[model samples]
Target: MLVLLPPSETKHPGGDGPPLDLGALSTPELTGVRTELVEALVELAGDVPGARAALGVSARQDGEIARNAELRTSATLPVLDRYTGVLYDALDVASLTRAQRARADARLAVGSALFGLVRGGDRIPAYRLSAGSALPGLPTLRAIWRPALEPVLAAEPGLVVDLRSGAYAALAPVAGAVTVQVLSERPDGTRSVVSHFNKATKGRLARLLATTTGEPADVVGLRRLLRRAGLHVEHAGGTALTLVEPAI
Candidate 1:
């Protein structure tokens, strides 16, 4: 199974791995797009004001632009280790056993505004970009990504669990992938879509899937896998799964 995860705005800086190498990443079809976007980012980074405006960041966040400037040369880490936030914090990859980590390296992939797509084991550098950002001299990111990303993702052989956030998901919609909705159940029995908690739940779910001994063949099998991991999952409909968590 392929688990598509969303990239985090925040990352753990500096890595022991070599610099970013697009050729080495999975989904070679995205190489051209990734190179184009990276070049745009590096060029824009030359103009602090332009970069800040394009990236939707404040003056204090100019450091992010600097990071973008060094995208190609910066030391790198596995994509899973590079990103950090609610979802990644919950995934807690650092704590996984060797076997579980190996499984994670095999099954996980991250959706990126910069790289287009990256596998868990793919080494990447700290860079600043968002799926919503419209870089100068480029069409809408979604437009640039869809044509390139969709076909690559569509070619995946088995069940795909897409946990990308809205904007990243829009970058490339997986035709029949199972999408998850995280809901927090209240004491009164009402459930509401969660934001912060949603990421955490998805992270936990990804960890579980990564560690599972057997790959799930279909949605039913996926439900069984998650259930075995102690998560409350319900089939919402075709290509949809609702994960209910206690009110937080």
Candidate 2:
């Protein structure tokens, strides 16, 4: 039987600092508090089953504490990025101090477990194979790119393109914006590009256009349009969009 503990205050034994006055701190500060709590819980729980059970209870209690702290720190966190719509608070990892980074890493592990639960049984495929290389198969490769585009395209009605120059470009007609960036490369010397749609490229005949655009420009809308147009959109990242017929 699973036993859940009631929320309670358990002071940090080290007394590093009073339960992180998150209300007075920044998002980075709140992240630090969260990291500390995770570390303390992990230490307390150790490797025993009983410790694991206790840690679960501690996590639930601390999550509420962290949320409350975040509310106080919300004013300090940056606003969501205009293009991607991903919350700046969620992406504030780079601003954390080294100690904070360690703590954040532990919290991230917990968060990953939560994501796994919400995804049901679908495991994020291991991109690297046993031979220290990317796994073979076009279908798997396509799957990798789909998720990367889904969230971004859903938030902004545009195409994400990976350019040959090893940069990513996000084009949006609504904001009249085009951003290009270079993504990291794999050990095997493969680079990726991601481009979004804008007025300049919207009417162009392109594979990504065939796969991701329609009259309205949203991903779901474009998907329906692609189906009606009898086009198959594969998941080969930039390669898929590059293959479409050129615009006249």
Candidate 3:
């Protein structure tokens, strides 16, 4: 299965890996646009205030812009290690076993504003960008990404599980991709959620799927996989599942 996760706004800086190399990334189809976006980012970084406004960052986050400026030369880390937040904290890449880590490298991919898409094992620098941002010389991310990204994702080998946040998902939506919604069960029989629970649950679910020995052939198989893992997964209509948890 191909499971796509969302990139985090916050990231772990610096890395031991070599500098960014577009040709070496897994999805070679994205290299052209990746190069374009990367160059755009580096150029924009020359103007701190303009970049701050364009990237939705603040004065205190100037270091983030500096990261963009040095994107081509900065040391890199695996995409999974580069991103950090509640979701990534739950995935906890450092704690996974060797076998599990290998599995994760194969099954996990991330939706990105800069790279378009990246696999778990892809080495990349820490840079700042968001799905909602509009760079000065480029079109909307959705426009720049849709035509190029859609075909590449549509060609995936098996079931596609998309766990990206709304904006990233809109960047290049997969046709009939299996998706999950995390919900909370309140005492009043109402369903709602805080984003914290939603992201954490998805991260844990990604870890479970990554480590599982059996591959899910379809959405039915995917749901079975979740259910067998002890998650409260229920059908929530076509191409979607709802994972219900107690209200936070």
Best by TM-score: 3
Q: 2 or 3, which is superior by lDDT?
A: 3
Global fold similarity of model 1 (TM-score): 0.97
What's the candidate order when arranged by decreasing TM-score?
3, 1, 2
Q: What is the TM-score of each candidate against the true structure?
A: 0.97, 0.18, 0.98
Deviation of model 3 at 42, angstroms = 0.4
Model 3 residue 142 distance off true place after TM-score fit, in angstroms: 0.8
Q: Model 3, stretches more than 4 Å misplaced?
A: none
RMSD of each: 1.0, 18.7, 0.9
What do the candidate models score in CA lDDT, each in turn? 0.91, 0.26, 0.93
Give me the candidate number with maximum lDDT. Answer: 3
Roughly what TM-score does model 2 have, to 2 decimal places? 0.18
In model 2, what is the error at residue 83, expressed in angstroms?
28
TM-score pick, better of 1 and 3:
3
Tens digit of per-residue lDDT, candidate 3, span 1-248: 89999999999999999999999998898999999999999999999999999999999999999999999999999999999999999998899999999999999999999999899999999999999998997899999999999999999999999999999999999998999999989989899877998999989988988889999988899988888988899995689998998886
What are the per-residue Cα lDDT tens digits for candidate 1 across 23-82? 999888889999999889989999999998899999999889999999889999998999
